[model samples]
Target: MTQSEFVNLVMPFKDKLYRLAKRLLVSTEEAEDATQEVLMKLWDKKKGIGSYRNVEAFAMTMTKNFCLDRLKSKQSGNLKLVHSNYADDRTSLQKEVELNDSLEWVGRIMEGLPEQQKLVLQLRDVEQYDYDEISEMLDMKPTAVRVALSRARKAVREQLIKKHSYGIQ
Candidate 1:
């Protein structure tokens, strides 16, 4: 593919790619570097880009792998995932505070999850990717993706309940 064609194909999903990286790396600078690296890799293989049936999915997979590798590297020692995607300005002050607290708990809970569960939750709940797409991106069977998402959600719910229940397990 030519430069312009490559740009056109990738521009549509570039932000999603960056968001995924950011979700995993939890640092804007690292996410930017990861996004750039993924783009460079795609560009390097532009000659075969047309062979991919879903270029976006392929790109997403690349982003996911690249970010995971970074997370596993020694350089990521100081990094930690912290997401704050909830917002509701129109609510009462008390409601807003409660919402913030709930979101904080959610983020902490997510951080404690296993990597597979966390990635499955992030892709399915945050990114709104369907089971098939998540399975394809994560290289899991569709049923396995569903099971992981279910278990992740259940784990989060159980943790929240335990916290709210005053140390009861």
Candidate 2:
């Protein structure tokens, strides 16, 4: 692929790649580096990239693997899993505070979930990937993806409810 073609193909989902990296790595700088590295890898392989059936899925899988590997590395001892993607400009100050608190709680709850469930939740809920795409990226069956997403959502919901309902009696 020519440089323009490669740019056209990859630019659209580059933010998605960064978002996934940030979700896994919990550091903006690390996520930016990871996205750049993945983009560079794709550019280097641009000659044969057209042969792939779904380049976006391939790129997402690459980003996921790269971030996971980084997390497992010795230098990742200080890295923590936290997400902060909620933003709404129209809400009142109090509403925004409440929303931030709720999202923080959800992030903390997600941190306690299994790695698979966290990935499933991030892909399906945060990134808005479909079941088939998530299945391909994560190497899971579509049904399995659905089940994991369901369970992850249920777990987050239950925990949030429990947290809010505490001391209500």
Candidate 3:
């Protein structure tokens, strides 16, 4: 893809991509960095992007892999590092805390999902990809995509119920 074509094709996807990264990272700064990194990657490989069946899905996969790496390292041996990832919020930030809290909960719920469920849910819910798009991206049949999403939704509901019962401390 040419520079102009790539820019025009991808500029509109920024917000959606950023939101998906934020859902994965739970930190605005990290999400912003990931978004820039993903965009930079696409720009750097503009020639190769045309070979992919779906560039947006490819970008989302990149963002997810980046966040998953961070999460893994944080869980491995970086207590302070992970805590610090979310420590720099400004007092006067415009976003309501409640919204962030909700996203965080949903993010955790998503993290707990099985690998297939999580990817399917992120594609379908977070990225607004329909079943066919999701199936195409994940190389699953549309019926399988629907079944996985249904089961994943039920699992999330059950986990939420149990968390509530335990007071979610």
Indicate which candidate wins on TM-score: 2
Residue-by-residue lDDT tens digits, candidate 1, 66-113: 988987873456533222222233223454335447677688677668
What overall lDDT goes with each candidate model?
Answer: 0.81, 0.82, 0.73
Candidate 2, residues 9-83, lDDT tens digits: the string is 999999999988877776789999999999999999988898999999999999999988987872456433223
Q: Could you tell me which residue pairs clash in candidate 1?
A: none
By the TM-score metric, which is better: model 1 or model 2? 2
Ranking by TM-score: 2, 1, 3
List of clashing residue pairs for candidate 3: none
Give the number of colliding residue pairs in candidate 1. Answer: 0
Off by over 4 Å in 3: 77-116, 139-144, 159-169
Model 2 ranges with Cα > 4 A deviation: 75-100, 167-169
The lDDT leader among the candidates is 2
| Weakest ten-residue segment in model 1 by summed lDDT | 82-91
- Candidate 2, lDDT over the whole model: 0.82
- TM-score: model 3 vs. ground truth: 0.65
> Candidate 2 clashing pairs?
none
For residues 1-169, could you state the per-residue lDDT of candidate 3 as single tens digits? Answer: 6778988988887787787777666678988998999899889988888798888777766777776777677677655565554434322234323335655666666765766787777778767788877776667889999999999989989967865665545
